[model samples]
Target: MITKVTHGWRPGGLVAYLMGPGTVEEHVRPRVIASWDGLDEGWQPDTGPGGALDFQLGRLIGALQVPATRAGLPVSGQAPPGRGYVWHCSARLSATDRTLSDEEWAGVARRLLDGAGIATTEDLGGPRWIAVRHADDHIHVAAVLVREDTGRRFWPHHDYRGLRCTARELESELGLTPTALADRTAARRPQRAELELAARQGVEPARTELARVVREAAVAATDPGGFVDLLRGRGYLVELRRLPSGDPIGYKIARRATTPIWFGGGKLAPDLSMPKLITRWGQRGDATERLDAGVLAETRQTLERAERILRGARQGIAAENPDGIAHAVGDVVAALGARYGGALGEAASCYDGAARAPYEPVPDVGSVGSELRTLAGYLLRPRRRHRDDLDALSTVALLVALAALVQQIAQWRAEQGKRHQATAARDAQRLIRCTAEERRPRRGPPRPRYAREVAVDHSRRENAVAAIT
Candidate 1:
């Protein structure tokens, strides 16, 4: 797992996106120093005129204290035990690489609280919530900051930028690398390249946008209501406000809605808020509930079978058995049923291609072609006497190919200095291109708003929207 810290934003957005969700349980508060002693009196919230900046700074100070405050910690005038006395700031954590199970994700939150010197408030019946979003390859988590000792309320302060470095330190403690934020690109003229292209086409958007729109429409179909239909009609979720109460609500659910929220009883919908829906559905004694349980059971069984195939392939990779390798690969591909679903075939290919290259005297640059041939012969002979297992045979072939690739690349760096420099360059280029190809978007076509047919084709155009789980 990886943690990416985004800081230096205006506090309002950061706080709303973090603490405003109203689900994060307070674990600690007054996370930093107690009070401002030597600073100007104008720094106070109720200060002199022109207090906007000062007010923000004051809010920052309070926000820093919120974690500890929620943790029931007092504002420490003097240096507190085990607490680092330095600059104050705020930060948010995003997980990368792999999706986490609910239990695994809770553990992450617990670690963050403990590592950051905020005592856990589990005893106080505090709520701990994880908001999983799919817009980016990261999970947005929010938790209330509480005081462990006094059980007091703590609010987040305004100036929270310094937490960037602090987050990195905490991430290291949890056995994760801090994902660095990419820098902004150089600014250009007001008339942008994408805009110009859209303007010239004058009808539909480029192929990319069309594909994106289709994907959104597809996933939205999963919602219980006609959420998918709504997205197709408007291209985005419709914003609406309730009168009298003035509570904010939206009509259409977003195309990609993986948010896990904790709310009152009326908000229950088996297909809407899935995690809670599942939990609630499992608790009831009804025919529908029983059917849902059976469906889940079947899904689990299918996944288990796939896992077995993948495990076998991994074993083949380790043992260097060509037939076993081929069998494993075939099993995996067959289990995927051609759709590929969320299988990491491309990543596996990288490893496989590297592993199965023809084995020359020097390692890492050639295939073990002879071994693969021997393994293939063994499998073919056995099949002649008995029923052939197509999937198993395919697995063996894939493993052999992977082993050969690995061996071929082993001595790649040996081509150093002037003599083999050109060969090295070519190898590097090939590797880069291959990796890029693996990651390229599988969906085709772009959709832009200005195209003549863009609005007409609001419905899903492809079967690309799928939930891997």
Candidate 2:
């Protein structure tokens, strides 16, 4: 199931829409399924012809707005844009899911409102709200934020997140099609304006083009200067937003065009942001460092170190970070992509979300993280190695270890409620595992996400561990 949240100040407008013909004539038998006042209280009024408003509709709208009205909130006229008295959420079942009965839909609505704290079992007069069913597979939940008993305005804390959790639980309990959790790890989608402009100009959207270039730059460069140089080398325009102290605070990239509209790093992906990306390049050094027989040993050691750090973090409380390994892990994966340039490259791209946590900046790059970054730097150079230098067996061991770390990353992300990120991590890990699976040896069996790692011969792993659980 999927849910979307929206808000407004006018209860009349929302109620009228819910009870009337939908935007696409999709509404079928529009009527109330549930309300803050029980059905016996007549919140659902008779609809006029074609589900249009009538005198009784006024009563229903009045009932919803009473608390706000009593609390001296203006219900009509140009009172102000953000009164936000109206809270609306639309919950829709997947097309393939079983259709829910009206009573079951009511229960779902009640559970969501209770879980979201919009209206709770203990707060009988918390807020006046209703669930309206106009279609078999969905319902619209509308609530006025003003509490009936106290006439005081109520705002559900973190209700958007709350709705997501509740919706997941409801999907499980009601046998609805499961949806991905609302982990903010996904890249920022291009807005309607950007899409429209792109369509008008007959070019790829600026956000899409910029994200591709920025991600490429992020993976290839070892320093801020190199990152900038790589973008410029790619023939894109790069502009740094800096502080008065001559330090770069942020950056924007754009395609070279008559009007080069720019996009910030954050607009590309959370981890792609300058502050976070810079932290991953700790003490920038040569990306073209030679790859030799010892390079295999170094890579294995780096991955093992990261695996151990994550294992410790998992054991620690939720408050502890996995020591910002995400930034460096992205580097490691991207380096593999740069070197291998096939499925590995696609894996690196998919792992982008797994390497980022929502809203959190990458903290200090620890010793292990630094090692991973340096290893990545060495791998980024294309002319660095021969088959004999990093043989198949040793390469398998490194891939296995990297897979284990990504699996642990997936688990950590899942624990942090970042399911989207976890999914991405798993996809990337799958691609990597698939690439190495047939030839992967069976000594040190790959541990599952969040499992205790057993020191074993890296060659002895099974289907490799997944990234971001």
Candidate 3:
């Protein structure tokens, strides 16, 4: 499903546009699916003697604007910009999905209103809203931003997040295509206008592309100077938000374009914010060091040591804040993705959300997480070709071990009641395992693990992906 939200100053105009003749987006028999008053029908005003559908539009418009008007606002005049007294949301189902009945759309409308705290059952003071379905696949929800009981303006907090959260549940219950849960720190999504613009320009949305570039740079960077240089080397227009004393505080980047759109690190992800990055990279002090790529045996040993600490250390990840450790682990996975971009890259990107810390900054504080951060740097450094039997075996073992580590994190997340993170981690694990199974035969000597196919749980995931071998 696709949802678009906007604030409008004119509630009557919005209501008219939604119910108007199919001028832009096609509107079939436009009818109210749901409303604040819980009316099924008959509430709509009858046409006047002039025979125009819009003749009695004022009747309904006046009704919708009651709360706003009572709150010292004009009856039909527009409010100031950005302080629009109306919230308009348009929701459309995928073309491949089945058409829902009016009753189902009503339920969806009610759920969305309640989820966003715009309205709730038995709450007389909530905002007055209506869901109008003008087409087979879409509905527009119009709401007056005033409490009916209190007659005071009410601005919703985290409305988009709440709407999407409820959307995930609705998609699942309605047997529609499932969307990835926005259950991590990186939850900024492109708006419908942005998506449309990107489509027209034949390019990725600025936000999405910049996020990937910034994240990859963050993983590879050794220090603040190196991080800036890395982005500059990639030809991005980089600028820093600095303190009055000339020390840098935050940063923003833009891709090379005729007119560039700059984004701050926080806009990309909470952890990617400048302060968080500085705090994190500052701890891993060796800025110019690189791992010995030829030492495959030593690499395996390092991974083994990481495994032991991850599995059995006295002050393990869970004892402290696990976000830092999760962030470090995700960095390693991201480096691997950058190293081999293909299906592996897809898997890595899919898992990115799972690795994010919450909105709060979590500096990679402890030694155990520090070890993983070091490994991440090692992976970011260039690797030599694997030749001898020991090298090939070690290389293969490293991939398997890394996959196992991801699975372990997934299990830990599930145990901790992070359903979305757990699901994302498991999905990444499956994809990485699948990539290994598919590409290993061509790359090197085969193992029994790749020869045997494992059964996948169809109940858990809907997509038909390669099974872990």
- Please give, for residues 10-71, the per-residue lDDT of candidate 1 as tens digits: 22333333322234532221111112221222222333364322223346445444544555
At residue 174, give the lDDT of candidate 1. 54
Error of 2 at 402 (Å): 5.5
The whole-model C-alpha lDDT of candidate 2 against the native structure comes to 0.78
Which residue pairs clash in candidate 3?
A: none
What is the C-alpha lDDT profile of model 3 across 1-469, one tens digit per residue?
A: 6667888788888878876665665666677778898884444556668544444677678888888878976545646656687899888898889999989998998888888878888787788888888788988899998997778898888888888888888999999876655555554777788899899999999888787778778878876778899899989999987899977799999988898888898887667788878777775634434345443444455556555555543235444445556667777677777876776677677787778755456655466567666656666666645343234455566667777777767777776667677787898888878766754645566656634433244533545443432
Per-model lDDT: 0.32, 0.78, 0.73
Query: Per-residue lDDT for 257-357 in model 2, tens only?
Result: 88888888988877778887776665444454454556666788778877877877888843234736765788788788767777887888789777766
In candidate 3, what residue range of length 10 has the lowest lDDT sum?
450-459
Candidate 3 lDDT: 0.73
RMSD of 2: 13.0
User: 381, model 2: CA deviation in Å?
Assistant: 4.7
Better of 1 and 2 by TM-score: 2
Error of 1 at 215 (Å): 17
Give the clash total for candidate 2.
11
